[model samples]
Target: MSGFITALFDPTMPFVRNAALAGFLSSILFGILGSVVTVKRIAGLAGAISHAVLGGIGMALFLSVRGIVPGLPPIVGALIFAVIAAALIGVVSLKAKQREDTVINAIWAIGMSLGVLFIAKTPGYADPMSYMFGNILLVGGRELVLLAILDLVAIALVLAFYPQIEASAFDEEFATTRGVPVQAVFLAILTVTAVAVVLLQTFVGIVMVIAMLTLPAGTAGYVARNLAGMMVGATVLSWLFSFAGLALSWELDLPTGALVVTIAGAAFLGVAAVRGLKALAKRAGRRAEGRVAGQEAGR
Candidate 1:
């Protein structure tokens, strides 16, 4: 721990500072989007989008290496693939409810397959695991700037459309009946989530990043009174998990993305277990009270 702190403060290691910033910024997106995604019960949809980004990343790498599109950034390609994936999923969800699972699964598998093929055909050795399980400690200045911009944009959008988002999230049918444009809102959610998936994938790795997205929000759900409260709680938890995971991974030489997700998963599961036990205790107490009342009446 001391070593990690020392390294973090060392003037020579700017990347460490960038990485910490990245975690903080990434947590903001994870918290806001995760809350809505959880409420909407679209984690599966978000997961598909997260994995689909690999296809764009792979394509960008291939193009850049081949000089077909020299210096093509992976994020740009990832955005394209993620947006397309989201659009398809949104249509299937809204129009073909019965085929939603099938479509989601197809996109998940096909996107990954395409990515693998592209990486394989690239001239040089490009390890897919590097992209799939990114090292946050290596985050650069460009990424941090982009992340800040995304954070601002997301916050503004959320502030501007909270009512519509809240209405559409909980009860789509009711929201639609009330003239909420649920379809547009749903598609917009998917699109925003997809773009976030693209950006965060490069830093956190798409393989298990969904865990970070959902786990924090899921944990917050236990105690949060409302969606806004849940978002605030989730954001705090996400940042804590990210920082703790980053520190532990640095100290122990483990994968930062996996570490972050694991910590979040543990915390979420612990909270859930405690809540379940509390509920059971309440029910047991109620049953005991009823039995005691019955015995006293008979007596």
Candidate 2:
């Protein structure tokens, strides 16, 4: 038993330990970002940006095949392309007055199609699945460092721009009237969303990134009375879900992304149920009070 415990917690088990830490960090980052995404009704944008990563992944693969970039990782390419795609979508949506969802769908389709074509043209590209559906086992020391840096950047940005983001999210016109830079705030949100989506895609796949971004935040929103509480609750919920999913996947031989998403979904449903029950109880209590008051008056 002692040997087993030592082996499990050993520093030499960097693979498992680092991967777990990365997952936890990713969950917290995404959860915080997800709050803004949900409040702004941009949860679907995460999906769009995630799918758009295919273009970056494909570009990276093409570069590697030609040896134009020897050490340029696919994720780097994905981040660049995803950011561009997200910016383009934001610009187009803002300029044309089109609904955000319409712009998002257009970006998603084009980016994914482009990525697929690029990958098809590339030779010996066998691991597109990792980008489509995350492989936690593939995370390494570099990824851990990257996650740490990104987390710092994300947290700093949120802290620095909290007021603008909060006002814009609640009311864009009101924020603009107050002399806030609405366009800049909107763009910043998109940029962060793109980066967050890319980071999460490494662990949850592009398809599941939305779940990671929105589920925990949505659950937190259900129970929180204020935006600050919502963000804190969301981060905690995300971490819990990630840890639970990791353990369950290991024990059940399930796909890690799927397990993580399942845990998030369960949390969402549980929170919704609790909220519903509370509302029902509140209504019942009010009705009972009214009935008792009527009886006393009649007597």
Candidate 3:
């Protein structure tokens, strides 16, 4: 506790402060975007979108190394690629309907392959591990600023379209009857999710990014009465998991990103176990009540 307090106030440790701010912004992003992604039942699609950002990173790396647009940052490339991929996937899924999985899987594979090819072609030795596994310690002031902007956009959009989003998520036909533009809303949601996935990839990397997005929101779903409740619960959960993981990683000398995911996973499992036990207890109580009622009737 003493060490934690000391570290919290230490001015020399800019990385620690950056991580805190980034985590807060990230929590907000995950809260709103993850809620939408989970409630819409598009976790798999979101996973594909997250992985697809790899292609953009590779493209940026290749371009920068080859002296073609050397000023381009990989994150910018990722943002562009993510949005485009999201748009493409949304259109294909809307039109192909029955073959959506086939399309998503194809894009998933292609995106990963493209990333590998571009990185391999780059001049110097580039460690793909950072992109593959993530390192929150690398987050700087600029990334934090970007995260803040993205969080604001996500918050505004979610607030503006809450009713439509809620309506569309629960019942497409009903939402459509009410003139909610269900398809458009879904596409918009995917676009936003794509952006969030790109930003979050900086924290958790590509392979495990989907967990950060889905796990907290899914856990929140167990008790959340509405979309708003789910987002709030997920935001709190995200903040807790992020900071706890960061603290644990610092104390244990573990990989910060992986530790964060681990903490979130453990929390999710704990919630699931408790909920399962409660359900079993409820079932047992019902059976006992039925038996008691039968005995009383016989008496």
Number of the predicted model whose lDDT against the real structure is largest? 1
Which candidate would rank higher by TM-score, 1 or 2? 1
Query: lDDT per residue, candidate 2, 1-299, as tens digits?
Result: 34433543788876656656877888767767889888988877778888989888888888888688876777898898888888877877688766666788988888888888878877784566767778775678777787788788878988888888899999999999999998898888888788878876866688568887889999989878967778889888888887777677766767877788888999899889988999999999999999999999999
> TM-score for each prediction?
0.96, 0.87, 0.94
Predictions ranked by lDDT, top down?
1, 3, 2
Model 3 spans > 4 angstroms off: 295-299
For each candidate, the alpha-carbon lDDT, in order, equals: 0.90, 0.80, 0.85
Quote the positional error of residue 173 for candidate 1 in Å: 2.0
Candidate 2 all-Cα RMSD: 2.9
Provide the lDDT at 200 for model 1.
Answer: 87
- Cα-lDDT of candidate 2: 0.80
Best by TM-score: 1
Candidate 1 pairs with clashing backbones: none
* Per-residue accuracy of model 3 over 180-249 as CA lDDT, tens digit each: 9999999889877887788879666885578778888988989999899999999999988888877877
Tens-place lDDT digits, model 1, residues 1-299:
89889988999999888899999999999899999999989999999998888899899989999999999988888888998899899889988999999999899988888889999999988988987878787788988888899889889989999999999988888988989998888887888888788888887899656887799999999999999999999999999999999899899998888888889999999999999999999999999999999999999
